[model samples]
Target: MSEAAKELNDIKRLMMLLLLKLGASPDEIALALQVDASLIRKTIPSRKVKKIVSEKG
Candidate 1:
């Protein structure tokens, strides 16, 4: 990938981690980070998704 794309991916990963830690939804974190929610969702792991969902449930 190009440098910019790599950077964007890295930022998305960080945003996903931060969102999980902060208990924020993907849409909320995407809006705060000014990126796409699909990107955040794609970067997050299934285990992480389960954890987040379990916490909210």
Candidate 2:
């Protein structure tokens, strides 16, 4: 991927984690990010997701 494309991809994943941290559900996150929920699930493990949520909570 191009540099910008790679960064955008990284940022999207980060946004997913951030949204999850803010108490957004996977469904909500998928809708907000315009991605499939399955895509969201594939991008990051549930364990890390929970850790981010817990850290922010």
Count of backbone clashes, every candidate in sequence: 0, 0
Per lDDT, the best of the predicted structures is 2
Report lDDT per candidate. 0.71, 0.74
Candidate 1 lDDT, 1-52, residue by residue in tens: 9999999978867767866766777788779879898876777843455343
lDDT of 2 by residue, 1-57 (tens): 899999998898788787777667777878876878887777765556554345442
TM-score of candidate 1 to 2 decimals? 0.50
For model 1, what is the alpha-carbon lDDT of residue 9? 77
Model 2 scores worst on lDDT over the 10 consecutive residues at 48-57
What candidate 1 gets wrong by more than 4 Å, as runs, is 1-12, 46-57
Candidate 2 Cα misplacement greater than 4 A, ranges: 51-57
**Position 2, candidate 1: lDDT:** 100
In model 1, residue pairs whose N, Cα or C atoms come closer than 3 Å (at least 3 residues apart or on different chains), thus clashing, are none
